[model samples]
Target: MNGRPVRVVENLNHALHESMLADSRLYVLGEDIADPYGGAFKATRGLSQANPDRVITTPISENGIVGVAAGLAMAGDAAIVEIMFGDFAGLAFDQLLNFASKSVSMYGRPHPMRLVVRCPSGGSRGYGPTHSQTLLKHFIGIPGLSLFEMSPFHDNRAVLAHMLGLGEPCVFIEDKVLYTRRMAGDGQVDDLFDYGFLGAGDTAPAHVYTEAHGDVDCLIIAPGGMAERALAAMRDLLLRHEISCRLVVPSRLYPVETDALLDAARHAAHVCVVEESTAGGTWGAEVAHVLHERLWGRLRRPVRLVHSADSVIPTAVHLEREILVQADTIVEAVLADLRGEGSPV
Candidate 1:
């Protein structure tokens, strides 16, 4: 919490601990969530021990886990239910869609059922088909529930605390691999601070841009792992003399606050949007449309976009990494945008 002591990895752990500490009603229910396993990635590592009754570990049935949580939410208690892995969430569709989402808007009350159905998604760690899946695309159209896509490890600590205090129903998806690979000893557990990759274009694939405003030829927007990779690609482009550029990372993907994206668009001569998801109806494509309609003339050059080609997230580690939108792919897109022939692969 002191000067530059915060790390992304540790920030996540701090969020859960702080949220629970602040609110006793915030109970945790999910398979293997109790100490030891810590719900697979140890996000809930110390919850069971610290809070005791507040952290209730559950059986393997994803449906039962969520169903119980939904009932609790409807009863005016919001519970943070982890869906274990993204793939297994299929078992609890009925509860997630019909019950939890509806209890909020369908009843026409004061937005009751304040619960968060959390999932750790995305493909990485080579866990294969069932485990390695980025299912955010499927939930994009679901109504009655707020969707939150978390990609920033440091901001997560504060964001989680804020979301809990709001008392609204939200599906918070945690990128599964972030547990070990990303989280370390961040100081967020001690205090709340502003952690983002979206101010004045700082972060790229993972770490946001830490620099002050530079003369950027273009602004590239990418979130999750791709955000850092895309920025790397932007740097590579600069190296090759293709162009100078700034990068904007919408660290939070779903329920994306357009204010930040619009600001990024306004700063650069042009902007390119990218993501590790589908092109049509995706968060990236949505951003491009917003720019075209709202900030059209503000940009000297045409709006640019970069995204993952429409394809299944493969199971093979090497192939999967290749299929994902990479830094080189983003650089290629920037090159195309430079020539006035925009190509977002």
Candidate 2:
């Protein structure tokens, strides 16, 4: 009614516009976020048109922008800073990690860090090394910041609205590949993927796609872009290998939905995690560790993590295919484990 129904990009645009109108102090600040430019992915297309003064554009300096945003938040302004790429998040580390994340606790301040850093993350578009990085693992374990990744099935408008009210600093990641993908449907806020078990609770995990009814051979856990590939691989596993698995995807990266994850893993014979980030000190690694630690007795096989190669992303498409976890790689990994030919992580 308010605007046309949209895919991921437009949905995010809608959320940003609504949040600004709802709160007087909330403003958007980033490079080229103004109209016509509308950010690197056009998620902020009409935002500057509506609120010309509030949607502030700045020079190219991640550190300066983040530092300014932190200062504004301390002065009671709710600011959303959009970083063009996840790889450049390292440049803003001093402001985010040291000041924004620790300000509330250190200063014993009343108002929390009313800041949100929007990071466009993940890669499959041959962006090469620096432009294509997840960098999520680097931001985790910080005491005060929240981490969120938008999902196609889950309602982004609802999630962003809630996050804006949290009164804490947040790192919100937007996958580049998801920008053009249409929403699965006008789904209910609680329904992750038309499945019943995972609801819209704050701690609920997303049910990406599942066939784990009576006997589940494996439970495939993936995040962001990996969820789509994992679901595709699952179809092959069922038809060709006759292996059934459940796909559990999480929208929130930090403050993980531990209970929901554990429940899903307990019912499966094997648990496998897939991620776009490289192996070792990755989000997938953490997931596998937790599942192994908690459900070791319940699990029939050791937890496995299939991830991108631990090196800079490649420029060539073929090299990328070889490095990233494609449908074949996923199918191969799962089937190898099922056949007892591969070592589990």
Candidate 3:
């Protein structure tokens, strides 16, 4: 886990620590997020020790976490609540939807104390459906709350720092699958809530860093769960035929920022959107739509879709991989786009 080249971004940790330090009014409360035990996922590790008074661990109650966070926010405190999984958050919907997400507009609260609730959601660990639900679509209609899902290890730090700075009620989703994705078959790191930036291990912040090399024809936007497959395909392509490529892994998945993506596509003649979510009414489609609407004719090739079939994740490992996007499939799609073999309209 040490002395190995990794895309480990301690940025999320830095953001949490820095945010807590800068504001004494900030507090974080959730299950298993206290001292000694760290957290259910270690994102809350060491947080309790640094800010003892502010960092309190609540009972095994999602409803209480949401309800209390709402009250804290009403009192003008920046309270960060953690849920173990997105699926488990269903129990707290009454508190979140009826309270936290609605109170500001419903009650017309003056200050609207901010809340940042963090959780680890999605699949890839054979953890089953109880933990595999990517329930972002459910929260989309919950107007007035900020939503953020971090996919890559690189952007976890930057995205987090930005979200914590916004001073809004934010839902931060950290996928469990990314905790140990490899860099070179040697080491790994937790892919917590960094967004739109790169982490060179303990080194200084990196600016959009990637090893994708080739003739450089297409830009692929692969979010959290599918990033590794996309990167692996890029590497394999370069090894096979020396084709230049660029991949934009948005650390912040939901509530996407279109400007940064458009900027990347400015150089990429072709574009593709990859996600583990179903293609039906997903964010990837919106990204492709926006790229066309904003930067018409800038793309030399059609946008390709690499996503899971519109079905629940199957239980079998091989079955799951079959339904999800694959490295080989990503390479094939890129090759099609580069070779002018894909749909141009």
Candidate 4:
């Protein structure tokens, strides 16, 4: 695939613009999304100029904005509402978990809650606690909501375009730190993972990075942003410790497509789950539990979960680094487990 040089931010902008052009029912709504400001992260730069009638700038009320989008979806229009920051999702929880989530299921007739909530998530750039939390875990258990995290190596444009047609409520998470980073394909460097479907179904695409034919000692599962560090750690593990590993970066966070994850783990000697959200009752924990429950008898070791500190992320650059998971941190965890220094399953 001859892919062009695309930054994460540009991918988002392209997806929004292209989807708007393709569908007349699609509308973009959020605070400071119009031109001049574009958005808090400029993901909607030229959208307002392209479609003045549909690109709306709303007042600072997450609940009100989401409620309005839900209503529009109920009325048969596809609405993309940006929550500005993941931390602000709390303000709209009632609207999301109550109405948007259960609309289709509650009514016997398919409601098609075609509302896509774009959340700028994850910490980086020292944006402070209130603005920088990875709160995707909070919405993971919602029965009818689909959750997605953009990976640098994946084609976000294609994924977003497809999601626009699914007619389901989706939480599209855009990493703040990834906005500036160029996506991993430029006709030079090969994509770190072989992207494909996990099973016979249309679940989220599963990624397999490392040797294609042989078994991997460790199966590292991580979200998109956290996969960056996980890749680094995997490489370090290979070079330093001679531990062969395969990394699986999932695009879908909620309803985690488990076919490939379980398939990969069946061959691995150990399994590790990494995430950016704070530890304790996180999405990573759920993955760990499932892996253990399914592969407990066949697994060689306990599934380790490496996540961020369970406290408010500090604004101080140095302190923030200490709180968040780094490549070295993941390396240490994998190394310790592989070396038999940690507990077994």
Candidate 5:
């Protein structure tokens, strides 16, 4: 839809610029986000230079940053807070949970808290434990707080615009690795796979990519960051094993809409969820539960969840690889589940 294929980071930067130009009341608050530095991943690049007064660089305080954004949002202004590392978002839990989320419905009248906390998350790079973690699961189920992930299929411009228009607080999770990956444009992923949307055009819908012309044998559900891995596995399953697999990548994580998911998964014999988060109390687990309930008695086997090992992420590249979910992990999980080797949930 543009001159050249842009990366996720560029799309985000463009979105921020367009949003700033459209709305004078919007402000960007973050640490080391101003000027020459741009941001940790350059998602806010050129923003400070373009809008000096609106783009503010703050101290190393996640809580303070979010709190100030919330205050600004309450005053009828839109505020976007950028958390350099997704792990550090835990420091702002109180501000998000008690203040921003509740302010929407706690008061007699609904206060439009046009606040969006953009988190650069997920692991693949050797950023170590403190820097590389997907902590969005902790913020799930919080009232009035919507969760979103940046995907190649969905335009970041549309995502940012939608979040600002929601008039509510939202946590936008950006996979650190996805920043450099080329985004899919014109509904074209590649020559092998075809892409389509399952839900309404306006809202965030699950992106379905598949090579299968007939019924798919397996349906794999994953977030944006995990899309690459899911695709890799999808390719391996189709080419090496002759198995038809459909990959569904969703932009919205929490408060997940299941109508599209159920429609896509009902035909598949097996459903598998892949995530970078460690096993247990994960978004994948929640999805598995939902699939079990909705597709009960219609499925061939229980849903399988593929995730990282339940341990602290290591710094060494090889060690970290072992702990995190990889493309091979997904392929193995799908094969195992198909063979009836995966135990019941």
Candidate 6:
């Protein structure tokens, strides 16, 4: 590791390089990912030149790219497909839903389909509607498909390697804004909060950040792109309103692991979920449902959900900000819940 803090994009590039070197069967396929261009976000930088035979640049076809990756996985070779923009993932939904996901069990015996679809997702860069959208909820609950989101707290190297090791189809959501941000280290976040990991064993762990240890007024559960926003809200709430909050960021988004979350929720007076996606049938809703089921009749109020507006993202910078979930949005939601002014669940 370097002495300086590693950027999220650099970490991902390192993971791809290291994983490819370790496993000869690993291949990376995407558009404009070849050397000299190194992809739109530069996450695939130096990959093509280093492994010319393994790293392939294909034509513009989201469906075809994913289809080819799925076919490669079925042939016993691990493949990683990069969807240029998260919005275009919809074009390849049929391939992912029917072919990639079902191949694990549809055959006579359980097959190991080592396929990873890396999507540069989420808004905040003012990429407009077609280019910006956090569509994680749409891919949730797919059988044999594991969902993960990139965060500053978790190492992308481990995430990529772990998914490949699982030998199943995985959707690795990379928040575009996170690419340029420096990763947190030494049990610290923005020099304002101390952080630590919860949950034991090999599974991906939830990262908990707090200004100080002990009981908090509220526990905020956020994933991926919402981590920074959640942390900002936590800081503002504590500094301005004296509302102590504990922020929990999980790397794995799907197949909800509630042990760590339940432990944290039990101690807080209130709980809130923050996400970039719009309301309705969201990952936050799923988490809230699970928490309610497990922590029945013990919470002060219903789990508050803080999310983006339920509308298409606008191209204007100010309009996009209004549509997306900002730090202030989270602070207000938490404050409302504390004041008993939150909407009914």
| Candidate maximizing lDDT | 6
Could you give candidate 3's per-residue lDDT for residues 227-323 as a string of tens digits?
6677677677767867656767665555666777777778777888876666667777778778888888666665777766667777778777766
Model 6 lDDT per residue over 23-122, tens place? 9999999999999999999989999889999999999999999999999999999999999998999999999999999999999889999999999998
TM-score of each: 0.83, 0.92, 0.78, 0.93, 0.96, 0.97
Relative to the true structure, candidate 6 has a C-alpha RMSD (angstroms) of: 1.6
Model 4: per-residue lDDT, tens digit, 1-345?
A: 555577889877898898899889888999999998999989999999989999989999999999999999988999999988978989999999999989968998777878989889888679888988988888878888988888776677777776666777898888788888777653223444444445443335545565566678888898878767887887788888888887777777778767767887887898889888987677888888788888899887789888887788899999999989899988888888888777322
Each model's total of backbone clashes: 14, 0, 14, 1, 0, 0
The digit string of per-residue lDDT tens for model 5 on 1-345 reads: 657689888888999999999999999999999989999888888999899999999999999999999999999999999999999999999999999999999999988999999999988899999999999789878989999999888888888898898889999999999998998867667777878777666345655566433568999999999998899888999899998888888877888878878887887889999999987788888888888998988999888988888888998999999999999999999999988896534
lDDT tens readout by residue for model 2, 1-345: 654447788878888888888888888889999989899999888998999888989899999999999888888888999998878989999898889988867875556778989899887899998898888888878988888887776567777766667778888878788888765553322232244337656325667444335558888887766767877788788878778888877777787778888888877888888877777787777777788888887777778878777788888988977877798888988887887775544
* Residue 282 displacement (Å), model 2: 1.3
When sorted by TM-score, best at the front, the candidate numbers are: 6, 5, 4, 2, 1, 3
Q: Which of the two, 3 or 5, has more lDDT?
A: 5
Query: lDDT score, residue 71, model 5?
Result: 99
Residue runs of model 6 more than 4 Å from their true location after superposition? 201-203, 211-213
Supply candidate 6's per-residue lDDT for 17: 94
TM-score of predicted structure 2: 0.92
In candidate 5, what residue range of length 10 has the lowest lDDT sum?
Answer: 205-214
Cα RMSDs of all predictions?
A: 4.9, 3.1, 5.4, 2.7, 1.8, 1.6
Error of 4 at 93 (Å): 0.6
